[model samples]
Target: MTDSLHDIPAVVNREGGALDGPNSLVDARVPAPIAPSGFDLLIDVRAVSVNPVDVKIRASANGNGTDRILGWDASGVVLAAGGDTHLFRPGDEVYYAGSLDRSGSYASQQLVDERIVGRKPRTLSHAEAAALPLTGITAWESLFDKLQLTGGSNGALLVIGAAGGVGSILIQLVKALTDVTVIATASRAESRAWVEQLGADIVLDHTNPDLARQILEVAPGGVDYAFTSQSRGRMALFTQVVRPFGQIVAIDDGRDLDFSALKDKSISWHWELMFTRPRYGWNLEAQHELLNSIADMVDAGRIRSTLTRVLSPLDATRLREAHAIIETGRAIGKVVVAAER
Candidate 1:
């Protein structure tokens, strides 16, 4: 902490409870953020993007009963670096999905590990840059790391909830890096078009009761991989539609799922949580490297930002509205709130 939290205003979840009420999140102040002694950088936060995790965290704050800042993805300029910091300097433009253990990017400034931060994509504004980190990391790890895809797999992929932020980027990455055929699930007309534009080879109405049959009609035997961006009851259906030895990956915290259904078919199930690296200090620099590569791809036009909505000068009111939009499960991509310069 830099200055006392009581000294500066910020949006916060002072009392974790249901977001249905106005008091669920409110205008509050947090201690001015400060970089620790080493391995961290202090940033002047300029923009932030919301994720479903924000809503969950707000609704389940630590039982200690103290308020906490709520943001994970942000783009900003570095203002200070710890004594041991080597990757960045004051005035550097950066973006990152911050660690789960620290103060977040919902304030005027924040502290972030330099190892997990990346140079902002040259072609994007702070608002656009903020939208990429969390989802970018999640999508990258979920596809390549968990699925172990090294390109030219010639496999077919089925993306459940394919119009969301992670799915949007995953589709682009699959299209850009491999010959894999992509079948994306999108229920709405606009979302269907969105995934198609992002390079999904086929689009199916995930709302259909016979979604597996629909995918099989187009994919022949079954898809070689399944990325379940959103599913619960549908896991069984996925097991039925995936080819033997197929891979199933997910970014969500799926509960009540039994892996036994995939036993005979030899399916491999993997879970991806982008926060794992930063939280445990495990290969933390991977985020920095991956973000840079993604930025390069963005500059080269092989990939694009998934930002779909923007609000200005982040505040509790605007944040609450963003939360509502996310909870409704209708947001097509990332929703951002940028501070006016």
Candidate 2:
């Protein structure tokens, strides 16, 4: 580890508890972050976006004896690189979904692996760029990597929960690269319109049984691929709407699900966990490649940032408020906490 230049303030949880009370707030004496293994880059964090994982983990995650810092997606500048790092150097502006194994980016200074970081798109602000990494990676891997979707797929792509973080970005990705018509499910009027604005070819109400009916009216046989980013109870809906040999990819971790119901149609099931690469230390460089590729796409106008809101000051109060908004299940797009102004 290199010598510490300065200690930066960060949001921290000393006991790893709930977000409602004294447990959720800013801290002044939070230690500067460290990345002691595999690879490391000191990042001066500028902006960060909140996801359900942040709220869930903060409520339930345990820290190793010290307080646990919380954040995943960040847009920032590199300050230093560790010995094994070659992909980036000091002063490079980058964005990434950081590793779940260590301290996160809710700090002014953080250490992350170069392999999971990429240059920020020229067109986006730091907060906007910060919103893309986790959701973007999840959506991209779900469609192209997990579902194996391409331009030649024989049917439409059905996206469940089309207005949330991952779904919002996923809709845009499918619309941009694939020839497949996009069918998105959003129960609210605003969310429905949001997905359409993102280029969804059709929108259905996940709350209505008529959703399947509506989907069938447009796509008679069934969809070729289904990406579920929201409630896993919708897995049954996926079973009903996907054609034989169709693929189902879910990022939601619903429990006690019965896969036996899907046996007859031979529908394939896949779980998309964006942290898999960083978690198990497997092919860590792929995240860098993916983020860099996304930067190219964003710069080219093939995709846009999904950031819908920004909370300033990057402190615990704002972080908790952002988390509460998302937990309401009504946020139309990503919500970011910008660095101190």
Candidate 3:
């Protein structure tokens, strides 16, 4: 079915700027997407979560003047499915971190590939489930794909910025799936408590200049794996605290990282971006499988949604508010916005 004129509600960023700018993020009505084909599923978006990517993109240069719809994590119901889609039906509830190449989930409706989508956790609300996909996929990939961790693996893992979305979920995934000891860093008391509650075995203040000494006190020799959500100025720290031949994985876009610092210890550095799969079509179904696993874990009570805040009636204003919160780099857990009132 075709949409009525300007029927789909969306929040678009035009000429990216600071949150206070006139066009940073604004309410608009766009035409609904066409019928699903191939592996596509047309979704009636129920809830979406704000991530660091959204904030970064919103502040980027918009030289082309395209109105960008910036969102990744979403929980929704399938409204229709393409002929080749075998995983879901019209009424199935699902969640996914959609491709960065397409219009994202900050809208009333969206079209996503079934390969990157999964059944939503039955026990969680849409707002809660909305907080999982992007961060969940990232954490899963970082542990299994990048760090090459398995269920029987036993080692100490140091998580930097452990109170944010990915780190919060990462800690839980590690604790549930492996026997690793988690040493997480959080600069604030509430953030420290949040990570600890999520299963961190040890917590350290990220602001402390003597962090390496504290980590060494716990791990003795050094940590076996280090995951940093923000890796801008911490490469040297990882080089010092990660054991010889240990692994370091990061999700940041810091280009000034010095790889030379890691050579003396034979340390390996890896980068994880959840969009890499959908963006490259590299084993896209892996995300579908991993997300399903995460959902099962959530349903079994081994995992919990990290959703900590909810903003209602998804609109440009609320989206801008969410972006501002993320930009501060101090948000604990996840923040979601419900598409409907």
Rank order (by TM-score, best first): 3, 1, 2
- Summed over model 3, clashes come to 0
Q: What is the per-residue lDDT of model 2 for residues 1-341, given as tens digits with 9 covering 90 to 100?
A: 12345556788766556667676655655656565344788899999999998878877746464567889999999888898888887878899999888789888888887888888998989999999999999998998889887776646988888999999889888877788888888999999889989999988888896787788888889988888866456657767888998888888878888887788899988999999998898888888888898899999999899999999988888898898898787898899999853
Can you write out model 3's per-residue Cα lDDT over 1-341, one digit (the tens) per residue?
23477478889889777889999998888788899999999999999999989888888999898788889999999999999999999999999999989999998899999999999999999999999999999999999999999989998999999999999999999999999999999999899889989999999998999999999999999999999877888878988899999999999888878899999999999999999989899999999999999999999999999999999899998898898899888899999999764
- For candidate 3, the C-alpha RMSD (Å) to the true structure equals 1.8
* Model 3: residue 1 alpha-carbon error in angstroms: 20
**Model 3 residue pairs with clashes:** none
* CA-lDDT, candidates in order: 0.88, 0.84, 0.93
Which is the leading candidate under TM-score? 3
RMSD per candidate (Å) reads: 1.9, 2.6, 1.8
Cα deviation at 165, candidate 2, in Å, is: 0.7
lDDT score of residue 38 within candidate 1: 91
